[model samples]
Target: MRGDRVTNEGTVPSDSRRFCLYFAHIELAQKVQAGREAKRTLHEAGVAIKKQIIANTKSNKSERHKHLDELEQDLKILENELKEKEELKRQAEIPENAAKERHQKLWKVEKRAMQDLISRNNQMREMFADLDTNGDSLISIDELQKHRELDTNPENEFTVEEVRSILGSDSIDLNKFNTTVFDQLSNSYGKLLEPTRPTPEPTPLAEPSIDSITTQPSSLEIPTDEEDLRTHTRSSYKNEDDSEDDYEEYNHRGSSSIATSLEHEKHIHDSIAPEYDDETKRLIQIADEARNRYHEVGEKLLSIKRQIDDSKKQSSVDTGLHDEYAAIIDQCFDYEEREYTYRICMFKTANQIPKGGGSEVTIGYWDSWCGPKDNKYLKMKYSNGATCWNGPPRSLIVTLQCGTEQKLTDVREPSRCEYAMIFETPLACDETIATTSAHLDHVEF
Candidate 1:
């Protein structure tokens, strides 16, 4: 069977040649079948792999288009939001700019108004300064009536309390003269004018019945100056011999009718009222002043008598009354008048400091108790200070008075570089009647 051949010997029909036995070649047959099976498995696997690739590529393309569309929508939404915000800002700027302009205009108007007020106040200061003649910072209703610019009619007349309220002081307040007083005076009179005044006439005297003995005139805002009483008096026309004899007799009598020190001074305001401007008033004033002067001179004579008695006695430099007010020593007290701040240090120094920031000036230095002859402790003098511009050396006289509290008030420049003020304190309360009486109707420097 291994060598069997289909040749001409068999000569079988081509269709009958299948009977040739080849069973011995089974191994070759098996190898051929295995190759066919491997080819079939390889072709089937390739087809399946190609189909899967096409399907996956299509799905990926669709997903990419969806993602790109979503990204575009988000970008559009963000752009629209940005446009809305910009439009809102543009709308808001219209009112914001307008508000700024309005505020600027209002500020300008207010600034102009404030400047006008200051200018008006400055213009009024010169007019009011003339009202204070004695450097006492006071003005009487009778004095105010002299100016037609002031409405001094009875309906608008100023009482003492009314003046104190409107002026905010007992005197013509310089601080308020340019503010509240300016407004009030301007409202009362349409325009403010500087009063063209004549030389002042001497004030007349009056009787005591019109007002209380202890009280000053109801029309007066403050007490009339004692110096004014003596200096501004009208003399009673009489023979020179009679006047001299009267003075001599008063000196001999020695103020025996002087009831009390305060009462003696009060008689000028209480006893000699301005309504009693007759010969009787003149006689009363003359007698009162003579008694006061007699009291003063008698005390002086007695003081000299004591000094003569102690002529051989050793003179003492003991502090005495000076030490009583030693607590005020080295302590600074300030009194404001006009543009300067007056500073006084008891038994030390005095100064005038400018309010608008300038070099401080030395007013004076403590010198001595320069009061009247009888009571040497009533006034303190400071001298030999910084000189005026080509003038005398500056000096300050502090007049001491008895009061419940310690204070400095009424600073005045009576003469060139010569200053004066009143210092009230409790230390002077216990002085002798003789000392107090000497200063009753007068205080001499």
Candidate 2:
């Protein structure tokens, strides 16, 4: 029975109990399945999330690398640009430096040329002054001939052949052959004439006087009858009172003789006074006139001497401008960052530059009044020039010439902050044109 009952309970189970057991079993199985499924799902989800995270990290790293590379390229490009700019700056400075050097060279050349012109002009002026005769402004053939004749020595008179040899073929003009032919021929040869010796002064004469050779005459004699007078006197004296009267008469006669001699000497002196007075007045007048003439002659000689001294002083003082060229440069132009000007006078004090601005350039003449005749070169003062940054004020130099007009020809900058200028003027023209022509002819001979 127990066996049968256990079999029945197991086979047919109690409805409620069976159901409860079955339900509990099913629920437990479901819960366990659900837990298992949930665990699997969670593990799958974690794996997926890890995969996504790794992919995202790789993408982000790649982008960062790309950006870094781009930044590096940009840095390289900026460095190359900076290098190019540095090279361009170096190239730009070269031309400016070269220009400054070129201008300095030009200034030196222009200065030398101006000096040469001045020297040539001075030489011509001297020749003209030497040839000008008779203190006249013009030089004619006749006047030149007189000079030639005066220059020739009596002992060495020029022969026709000698004259021809000295003058050459061009000495005469066939169309103008008159009495002037001889004169022209002589003039052509006059330059070759030598200086003559001067004449000596004459000696003075001795004077003679009439008073040194005259002799004086003797005094006249007078006689008296002393014996007769003595005999008569003795007879009268025989009477007692007669002897005393005779003695008194002899004393009276002696006194009368002395009085007559004194009266004669007084009359002679009174007669000569008028003639002596006239002679003295005449001698005084003549002496005064002679003294006045001597004073006039002395004054003339002194004036001549003074003139000669002045001429000598002028000649000595007038030296060539070349010697003082450096000093002249200092006087003319001042150095500045912008430019420089230079000026020089051949034989006078020169101003180098001027003060101020603009295109107008002014030139001056040599200080002629302060210098000698030989030093009379034209001087110029320039003004309104370039300005400097932090240096001296604008200035200029004085240039000398022998031309017809005073004008600036050109201005330029040849160096860094340096300048050069060219000028022309009438003051630079040759004043002795005729004399220069004559000199050239002489040189050809």
Candidate 3:
């Protein structure tokens, strides 16, 4: 090649320089080709592995589907049985409908009686307490007449003579309140008042009246406050000097008071003699028996129904969880805090960078989902990161809450080197977003 372009004692030529440039390009091309070949081999291996995984998943799903057919058949039988029972109960209910009216009336009457007595007793106790305010179980005639509330009405204001007759003196000792000496002194009441007819609970009354619901003694409206109507023991005291027999005798003295006491108890329980005819009673018994049977059948049907529902869920086609978590793959989120910049690389690593230009600290590495079993994907646990100065290795729990877009927020150390952060992500929403992969030709690797 040492022709006219070369010298006799040749050193270099312009054309020879082109040859150097050509070989340099060739060497660069060869290196690039070698790198592409290695990348291709690795890419092919990854594809093969992915196909095997897909095949295994399909095999597992097929095995699960085999039991699904039998489960569906069982579910159908249970559904039919449940429907039959429900129809039978509906038919039985039609016959029992007539008896229900009488039963409801009886229950209402009984409730009215109890509520009325309770109302009356509460009022009576309040009135007596107001009459004797000095903590002495004695009602003074002076206090009774001069009392501010008693001035409201004539009925509330009794004459001095009338008060003396009841007390046997100027003061009435409530300890001896049942003493019926006033009965001999005056003929104010010749006959017992008529038995009070039961009324609805909402009606306020001072005293039980024979006029039934038509009258409510306005002076002392019933304390309808539910707390005032509670049943309580009659609180009394017997000093050491008082003998047991004497105490018993004092409590037993007043005949009229005794009659009133017995009548009060009667009003509470045996107030209205429920008179159901023999036919009505027979109908009630039949209805009650039917109700019991209906309830038992209903409970059994519910149990079967729950099982069917659970079976249906188990039998449904398995939509592999692989897609459920695909949205989080390779996603990274950052949160700016007062003292640190927190970062979370989903299924990778979590780290916190100091705001004051210090080295970034490794918080943790993604381990597994640590949420409750019912919703396993709600939380992501990361563990075994850089060890703390005087504590165990670092760990983190990323709590996922449903959001329109992904975010890392509220980064904090719940305990020393035990980090926690809230992650708002659309992947946490109820519905999973499915994704598709597209193949591209002429890939470098």
Candidate 4:
């Protein structure tokens, strides 16, 4: 059967085949035309339909005006909804930005607050460390009890309530309780319990002024009484009588010689007075005043020296107390500038002065150390030193140390109105034979 179909093509059904071909051609042609019409319609429309629909819905004069009005109402509703949605979106974005800003501000504030807290904690720790007498990490109740006992008056023992009140709440920060409070308590107790040093009243010096001296002429004027006059007359009469006897004995006394002698005596008196010029008189008055002042100063110095000598004697007798001070002075003091009489005591005092100036003209001392007795060993002498321009004065304390040579190591003006200097002197060096031996032992073999 397969071979017979391959040989005869007329065996195919013509009516069905013709009908299928005709339908297929017609469908193809219709499809091609529909595609062209769709393309043309899209090109020609150019969004006009959308515009027309919008216009029709919006227009009042049209057959479907009522329906267009209904659509317009719907569109208005949709637009209102869209606006609400956009506002909601904006509100949501606002919160996000606000939240970010708030977070940044909060972070900075929190960071600073934490740092402040840490600083306060460190300060509290330091306070605690200062208070911890035993260097232990914790303050014991026994120690606190002992302190309470010491603080409480013997007549009025501390009650539990009082102790609790002083300690504050049980939840109090133990770290905050330091020796400062105890120290303050101790100071208060000392003030109440211990005897205080009596303040010495300053000795009022008899400062007799120049005006006082002028007012009291009797204090100044030398006495020229009848006794003095009588004594002078007797001496002069006796000398004249002796001279007359000699003249009588030697009758040829030269007249020129006598005249010359009188002239020479007058010249000597004139030289002594020098016609009393204003400058010379003023200088004489000054010298007199200076002499008086010098006498007063000498008396004062004698008194001071006696007091110092007495004190030294007393100190030598008090071996226990005075020995320490003596040892300290021995260790610390230094001398320099033997030619200019400059002396410096390290950690104690320094003084300098010109040659032949004596203690009165000395430049004065500068004390660097503050001792237990609060005894000041120096004076500033602001008025006495060399003056400075637009400033008070240029003053210095030459600090001394152990050295082989007398030399100035450094000079500094720490403030606008102050100066300091470091000096070296052989006197400060360890000159003992033992010290030298020790130094030799330390040296390389």
**Which one is best on lDDT?**
3
Which candidate, 3 or 4, would have the higher TM-score against the true structure? Answer: 3
RMSD of each candidate relative to the true structure = 54.2, 52.4, 18.8, 56.4
**Model 2 per-residue lDDT at 46:** 41
Best-performing candidate as measured by TM-score = 3
lDDT by residue for model 4 over 1-445, one digit each (tens)? 2322332546543566656667777676667667655544443342343234335433522433454455455555655555555555555455444333333332332233333333333344443343344655444444344454444665776555554555553322333242223333434332233222332112221222222212212211211444543343334234323544433322232210111111122223233311332333444555555555545545554554555554444334321121212222312333334444444333233444456666522232432332234322211121234445686654554444434344566545586545555655333332232122111111111
Tens digits of per-residue lDDT, candidate 2, 239-259, equal 444434533443333311111
Pairs clashing in candidate 1?
A: 205-273, 206-272, 206-273, 206-274, 207-273
Model 3 alpha-carbon drift over 4 Å, by segment = 1-15, 80-172, 179-445
lDDT (tens digit, per residue) of candidate 1 on 282-347:
444555555555455455545544543332121222223433553454568888877999999877
Q: lDDT of all predictions, in order shown? A: 0.51, 0.37, 0.54, 0.38
lDDT of 3 by residue, 1-445 (tens): 4522655787545676767767777677677766655445444444454345456656654754565555566657766765776666666666455444433333343344445445544433344444566756666877565543333235654677755655578876533432332233223322223334443222233343323322222232222322321111011112233333333443343222222111233444554544444545666666666666666666765765675564454444232254345434556889997888888887778998899998988999978888898877778899998999988999999898655456875788879989999987545554221122222233221
* Candidate number that wins on lDDT, 2 or 3: 3
Clashes of 4: 1
TM-score of each: 0.26, 0.16, 0.32, 0.19
Lowest-sum lDDT 10-residue window in model 3: 229-238
Model 2 / residue 376 / CA error / Å: 12
Candidate 2 least-lDDT 10 residues: 205-214
